[model samples]
Target: MMEFRMKRISRKFSSVLAVISIIIISVMIFSYGCVKKEEKEITIGAVLSLTGKGAKYGEAIRRGIELALEEVNAEPNRIAKIKVVYEDSLSEPQKAVSAFNKLIEIDKVSVVIGPVLSNEVLACAPIANLKKVVILNTSAGTEDLRKAGDYVFRNRESAIPQAIKIAELCRTTIGIEKMSIIYSNSPNGKDYQNAFMKRFEELGGKILQIENYKDGETDFRTQLLKIKESHPQGVYLAGLVTELAYILKQSKELNFKTSFFASAGIEGSKLFEIAGDSAEGVIFGSPAFDPASNEPLIRNFVMKYRQRYNQDPDFFTANAYDALKLIAISIDKAGYSSEGVKNTLYSIKDYPGVGGTTTFDSDGEVIKPIRIKIIKGDQFVSFEKQEK
Candidate 1:
């Protein structure tokens, strides 16, 4: 009887132990599945001018966004892994529209980063707004963009602020009572010209003459001659890099002695190469981004950019970098969906960026403080304001 009872007890205890083991194993498997579910994935798109007149700017912007992508993925607490799709806009309006459409319908990306020209951005704005897709333009700064749509946003200031700043400098700082205007026939140029003229005249300055040259026109001799005939105290050149350089070169040839002022359109080493010594004394308004800045965020970015690209970064590069990182953060705060990101963006007050502190107005437009810089000995440096 005693031996029978011991055997029964031993069998029963073994069965109980096996049941407990199965329960523990089941719980472990469920936890693993939950963790796997938490690690999500998202996708974004870029429509850039990969092969066209604006290719260089687009390439710089691409480098900026890529660097941000790396940082975003490497964060340990990131809620999602992100992938980017690229489409070449060729820097044309019609091409930009096609790229925007494909990204929305085919790639199914909710957020997009580029199409560097103002015209290209304007072309894509309607579609993006209608589809509820988010577009953060890196370089386009036309005033018309202020009313483009609720879904369209830009990293830099519009033509109005830059134009107003330059106009103020011309009258108060440079003490120019009379000035002439030379502009390109593009939207970017026209916006700057219109705004600057209105502001300068408001400040009691007189406009001597206004001249315009078509886009892709390498020659500005006729316009320069006409400007020289005005013989104003200063000339506001609202043109891009190549055209501005040519204007400076030709203006120098004509001995058009006057103060040269420009909006934020003229930049890059190529300008110095083409304009040569004529680039000197060309003052322009620039967003406050100095690579040598001691601010840790800026310093770290400059170091990383140099290490990767083996070159110093510029204004456009910095803007693009900020644009991508902004999207990533907005997505994290909200979700990867376009409506989520757009709502979060509207709630943003002041965002600390590598370039500067960015704050978007109700129109989805941002305006940072502008720094006055002058070309001195083939390099840009801070210009000192004169005492009143």
Candidate 2:
């Protein structure tokens, strides 16, 4: 009887061990399957002017995105690995459309960022909508983009803020009653110039003259001379940075001392580099200011940017970083689905960004502060912050 009892006890212990082993194996297989199933990858497209007049701005934006990606990946709890594929628009509208199609149809990117120039953004915005992909503008600030479609979102403030701020600054600070507007005969230039003209006129300021130039025109002597004869208090330039620099140089040579003001087209350091001392004392309005911003994340970004690129971060780059951050936040908040991302972006309100706090209004316009800066000693110094 004792031997039989011993045999039974041994069998029972062996059976319990076998059951525990089977449970451990099953748990291991289930955990492995879940891990394999949960790996998600996201692809984003960056369509920028990487080879034309806007190349410098595009490169700066790319660098900013690179920096942001580094920081994002370094985090301990990232949801997915993001892959950014770049397409060069060359600052041409048709090329921009082609790139957009490729990104959507071939690369199959879930979302797209940029086409830094307003013309390019306008061209591609429709394609993005037709394809049901989100097109977030990092640098382009054309007012018409707001009405392009529901699929488009601008990270930077629109031309309206710039127009209103410039008008107020000219009226209050400079006491300028008369202004002359010179802009390139392009969609971007005309749009900005019109908005500024409207606001300036609304402030009881007289439009002394309005002149137009082609995009690649090297000689602005005729236009500058015409504006000089008008003798306006200020000459507002709405065009490419290269053209603006040429205008300034030529104006100075002609001994024209009228105060010069520009939209964000003149906010780049390369603009000053190209124009030399001519850029000094020139007032420009931007959707963002680098030094005036007090956010810690922005400060760190500036430091890292300078360290890596040996250049000061401009509004273009800062805006690109903010766009990426907005995408990341949306992904974190709503998961990695296209609809979720779009909904999150549309719902974003008062999100603190490097450029400033961004709140997307009904028209997909980012409501933020616009800042006016004066070029002093080869640097942009803040003159005033315009609250929106």
Tell me, by TM-score, which candidate is best.
1
| Clashes per model (N, Cα, C within 3 A) | 0, 0
Clashing residue pairs in candidate 2, if any? none
Query: Least lDDT summed over 10 consecutive residues: which range in candidate 2?
Result: 379-388
Candidate 2's TM-score? 0.90
Best by lDDT: 1
Q: What residue pairs are clashing in model 1?
A: none
lDDT of 1 by residue, 242-353 (tens): 7898899888888888889997778777788889999888888888778768899999999999998887888888998898888988998898899898887777777889
**What would the C-alpha RMSD of candidate 2 be, to one decimal place?**
3.1
What lDDT does candidate 1 reach at residue 30? 93
Residues 283-342 of candidate 2: C-alpha lDDT, one tens digit per residue = 878876475456787878788888988877888888888888888888888886667778
Score every model by TM-score: 0.91, 0.90
RMSD of 1: 2.8
